[model samples]
Target: MSEYDDDFAEQGQAVYEALLARTGEAAPQPRLEPTRRVLDLLGDPQRAFPIIHLTGTNGKTSTSRLIESILRAYGLRTGLFTSPHLVSFNERIVLDGEPISNEALARNWDDIRPYVEMVDAELAEAGNEPLTFFEVLTVLAYASFADAPIDVGVIEVGMGGEWDSTNVADAQIAVFTPIDLDHVARLGSTIAEIARTKAGIIKPAATVVTAAQHPDALAEIRKAAERDEAVVIAQDVDFELTADHVAVGGQVISVRGRAGEYTDLYLPLYGDHQGQNAAVAIAVVETFLGDGSQPLGNDPLVEGLSEVTSPGRLQLVGIEPTVLVDAAHNPHGARSLAAALDKYFDFAETVFVLGVLGDKDAEGILSVLAPIAARIHITASSSSRSIPVDELAERAAAITVPGLVHAFDSAEDAVFAAREWANEGTSRLVVVTGSVVLAGEILDLAEAEEWKKA
Candidate 1:
C-alpha cells in the first residue's frame, strides 16, 4: 500500500477499508435526504465555505482540479474533492493542493463516526438503509473542509447532480464539462435527461460555466440556467480556445473568457479538449473572480493553469515501452484519448491495454480505439464489475482488425505483456486505458517499479 495503508493513523486502515467496502454507486441513493441528515448531524459543515460545484460525464475531475489550482493561485485556501480516486482514497479530500493526511482522514472519520452511527440507527429503526459509502465520504469531506476553514471548496459530484450526495451544499458557481451518454442506465437514457439531472447543482442566481455540449445537452443546461436566473457562460460562445499548439511537454492555448481574452497561456497538459477544459475553467474563475466584468490579470491565471496537473488523464508512466495511462472509460472519453495519442506521440505501433466495467458501453469504447490501436491487450481491473478479460478481448477483436487481441486475467500481467511486446524493438507504445480502475492499478504498478518514461 506504499505507506498509504501502513500509516493508518490511530484507527488503522481497517476501519477505513470497511467504510470503502460499503455499497458504491451501483446501488443508488434515490434521494439526497440521507446525506442532508448526516450533514445536519455534523452541524452542516458544507456551509463553512463557498463552493464551486461541477458535474458531467467526463472531464469533471480535470476541470474541478484546474479550477482549484487557479483559485489557489489567486491566494484562496482551497479544499478540493473529486471522485473515484485513481490510487488513494485520500485523493478525494485535498486541502492546499495536497491530499488530506492519513492522520487527519482517520481523525475526521473518528470524529464523525458517532454521529454517523446515530443516523444509521435512526434509519434502521425506520426500516431504511443507512448512509452509503459515498454519502459518508461526502460528509467526511465537507467536515474536513470546514475544519480546514478553506477559502473555497471545489466539489465534484459523485454521480448525477440533482440527487448526488454532494448536492446538499449550494454551488456559487456551477460548472459542467462535456455532458454525454455515460451512466445512461442510472442517469437517464437521453442526453437531455442526463443534463437535467446534472443541472441540479445550479442554485438561484449562481454563475454557470459549461463546456461546448451536444445541442440537446446545451438546451437542457440553458433551460436550467434560465430557470435559476444564472448568468451563463458557455464554451464557443462566451469563451474559446482561440489558438493552441503542442509544446515540448504540454500545450499552449489562448482563451477568450467571459470577461476578457487571455493570450499566450501555457497549459502543461495534453489534447485540444484539455485546452477547451482550460477555457471552461477560466470562464468559471472569471465568473467567480471577475464577476464576468473584468478578467483577472495574466500572471496568476498563467501560473495556475501552467501548474495544473490531472493524473491518469493521458499521463505517461514509463518508457522504452513508452507506457501511457488514461482513464477513458466511455466512447466520448476514448475518442478524446485516441486523438490525443495521435497528436502528442509518434509511435510506429501502439498496443492498447484495455479494461472496462460491465456497465459501460464496452463495444462503443473499443470501436473508438480500434481506429488508432495496432493491437489490444484486454484485462480486468480491480472492480468487481469489470468485464472479463476474455470477453473484452473477444469484443475488441470483433471491433478491431482480426488477430490483434490478447487477454490477460489481471492488469499487471496485461501491462507486463504489453511492455514485452513493445520491448521487441517495434517502435511500440503501450496505452493502459478503458477504465479508471485499470489505470489506477497500472499506475500503482509503475510507481512501485519506479518506471521512468523514455
Candidate 2:
C-alpha cells in the first residue's frame, strides 16, 4: 500500500474515519441546517471565494470542469469541486488544474476538524444526528478552496440543488447544464419538478446560465431567476455552438457562437455534447467579466476553452479491445453515450457490461443502448442503491433485441465476463456504464490491477 508521512496520513485518516462512523445515522431529510451550521462555524469560508454553482441531472460535472479550466486559463487560481471520484477521493478537489496534494489535505483537515467536532457535539445535544457523508465532504471542499486562496471556485451540486449542502454558497453565477427526469423519487417525478429542485441553487441577483433544453425546465428556471431577480441566459436564446471542427490528436476545436466566432478553441474532451458545454462555459465567463462593465475578450475565452479536460467522459483507458468508461447514470446521459459511441466506434458487434442503481430507470438506459449492443451483461453496482442483479437481468430480458443477455452478481465479474467475450479474436467492442458509482468501482479495480503489474 502507498504510504505517506505518518502525521499527514493520520490527519487525513481521522477525517474519513469520523465520517465512516457517522454513516447510516438517518435517511437524509431535506434540510439545510447542517450545511449552514458548518459554514457558520468556519466563518462562512465559502464566501471567501467567488463561486459558480452548477446543478443538473446530467452534464453538470462536465460543464463545471470546463468552466474551471476556462477560469484557470484566464490566469485565475481556480478551485473545482465535483463528486463520485472515478479513482480517488482527491479527484473531487482540484486547485488550478491539479488534485489537492496530501499536504493540502492535511492542512485543511486540521483546520476544519475542530469545527466538525463542535457541530457533532451540538447535533448530539439538540437530539439531532451527525453530518451526513456528503455534508462533511461539502464542508471540507469549501474549507480547502478558501485555504487555497482560489479566485474562483466551481461547485457542482452532489444531489438535488435546493437543500443540497453545496447550496450554502450563494453563487456569483449559477449554471444549469440541463435538467431531466432522474432522481424522481427524491427530486420529483417530472422534468419541471426536477428543474425546480435544481433552480433552488440560485440566489438573489446571481447571474444564471443554462443549457436546459426542455421548455418546461427553462420556464421553471426563468421563473426562479425572476423571483430572485437573477439574470437568466438560456443557451438557444443567448448563445449557440454554430460548428465544431476537431482534428486528429488535436485538443483544439473550432467553434462559432453568438458572442463571436473563435477558431482553434482547444478542449481536451470528446463528443459533440462537449461542443454545447463549451458554449455554456463561454457564456459564464462573459457573464462574470461582463458584470465588471468591461466585457471579456475573445483571447481569454479562447484560452479558457482550450485548456478544459474532464476525465471519465468517454475516457479511453487501453487499446486492443478498447476499454472506455463514462458516468452515464441516467437516460439523458445514456442517450448522449449512445450517440458518441455510434459516432466514434464501428465494430462487428458490441458487448456491454452494465449495472445501475435501484433508483434509476434501468430499462430506459438499456433501451438506449439496445440498438448498438450485440450482447448485454447486467450486474449490480457496489452501492447501497444498486438494483438487485436478478431484477436488472429481468429488465434487460424484457427489452426486445436480437442481442444475447445475461446477468451477474457484481460489476467486476460482469466486466471480466464481457472482456472474455470481446477478446474472442473478433472485432467486438466492450462498454461499461449505467451508473457513476459502478464506473468508479470498475475503474478502481482496473487501476488496482494495473498497480499490481507495476
Candidate 3:
C-alpha cells in the first residue's frame, strides 16, 4: 500500500477505536436529545438533503440498500447509512453506492470531534452520560453526507425508531420492513409495543411505505400515520408482490406498485421476503420521485434490482461444499433464512455452523433452524456479547435430535469440521448463521481462503 493509503487506513482505525470507547449499540439510550445537541453544534447537517428513514425487525438493511441502489440508478447522488455493519465501520456510511472512502470518514470525524466533545462536556456537567457509539456515528454520517452534498440520504434506524439517534432528522419518506418480536428487552415484549416504537419515525405530512405487517403492528403504524397526517402506501393495499419465481443466483419478481404494475424485474437476492422488500423499495422510490403517482420506468427498475446486493443474506461463500452464510440473529430472520434454504437449494443434507449473541433468542433461532439441519456445529463469534459455545450447544441439543449437535471453540473450527462432513456426502451443503458478527467473520475467512474457487 502507498504511504497515503496506510495513513488513511490508520486514521480510519483511530476513528473507529474512538467510537468504540463509547457505550455500545447493544445498550442504546432511549433518548435523542444528545444526538440533536451534537448535530445542532454541527449546524444540523442532516437538514442539507432530503432523507428516507427506515426501521423494523428484519430486512431493514436489504430494503435500505435496494432503495439507495434504485435512486443511484436514476442518476441521483445518494447517501445511505445503515447500522451493525457486516465488516468495516466505513460500511455503515455509504456515499452514492460505495462505502464512504476512508479519507472522507476520517476527515468527517475530524470535523465533528470538537462538537462531539462539547456535547460530552455539557452532558457531564448535567450528570448524564455522553454521546453513544451510534449517536456519534449518526452525526458523522450526516456530516459526511452534507460534505458530499448528496441529493438524498437513506438512513436506517439503529434500533427502535422514536428514540433512535437517527430520529433527530425529519425524513421525507418513512419506510418499515416486517416488524416482529425481536429485541424484546430494548424495543418491547409484544409486537404492538414494538411497532408503536418503530412507528415513531413517521414525520408530519411525510409519505410512508411498508411491507406486509402483522395486524397489531399495522394498527400501530396506522395510528402513528394518523397523528402525523402522513400518507401510507402499504403492501397488499397500494402495492403488492405480484409474482416471485426462483432463478439462477437470485429470483425474478413482479410488483404492483402504487404508480403502476412492474413485471419480471429480476432481483439478485434470495427468498420471497426479498421480493417483498423490493416491492417496498419500489413504493418508496415512487413516493420519493413522483409522489406515488408516476411509474418508475423499466430502465431504473431493471438496472437497480439487477445490481443490488445484500451481503450475508443467504449469500454463497464457498462452492465445493456449497457453503452459505446468513445473518439471522433473531427468529423472524431465522425463519426467512430457513425458508430460503428450503426453496432455493436442493441439497440432500445440510450442516449448520451456528453462533449467536447472548441477547438474541438462541432457543427460538435453533428451534426454527434445527428442523432442516442434518447436523449443527455450534460455535461463537468474536463479539464479547456472543453466547458461549457450550451454552449454545446445550440449547441446540435440548431442541434437536440426538447426535445432531456438536460444539467447537471457534467459528473457524466449526466451519472446517462442517465442510469436512459435507465433503463426505454427494449433495451436501454447509451453512454459517446465527449472528451478523459470525457472518462477517466467516466472510473474511472465506475471502482469505478463496472458498469460492473449487
Clashes of each: 0, 1, 0
Estimate, for each residue in 1-454, the C-alpha lDDT of model 1 and write its tens digit. 2366456654535556857677776776867888899889888999999999999998999999899999989999999999888987788899999988877787788888898889889989999988889888899999999988899999999889999999999889999899999888889999999999999999999988889999999899989999999877888987888999998888989888878888888999998889888888998888888688887888899889988999999998998778989999999999899889889888888989989999999999988887777778889998999998778788887777787788888789889998998999778999999889889998899989877844
Residues 1-454, model 2: lDDT tens digits: 1344444666666666766676531245477887788789889999998999999888888899888877787889999999877766678888888877766877887888788889888988999877787788888999999988899999998888898889988898999987889878889989899989989999999989888469999999999999999988878777777666554433455544445556666666777788788888777876766652444566767666666667678776545666677889888898988877766566788787888887788888988888778888888777777888998888788884644688888788898777788778688877888887878877787676562232
Candidate 3 residue-wise lDDT, 200-228, digit = tens? 99999988888999999999999999999
Order the candidate numbers by TM-score, best to worst: 3, 1, 2
Which of the numbered candidates is closest to the native, going by highest TM-score?
Answer: 3
Between the candidate structures 2 and 3, which one is better when assessed by TM-score? 3
Give the 10-residue window scoring lowest on summed lDDT in candidate 2: 249-258
RMSD of each: 1.8, 2.9, 1.3
Give lDDT per model, in order. 0.88, 0.79, 0.93
Best by lDDT: 3
Candidate 2 stretches with Cα past 4 Å from truth are 1-10, 24-27, 249-258, 292-303, 448-454
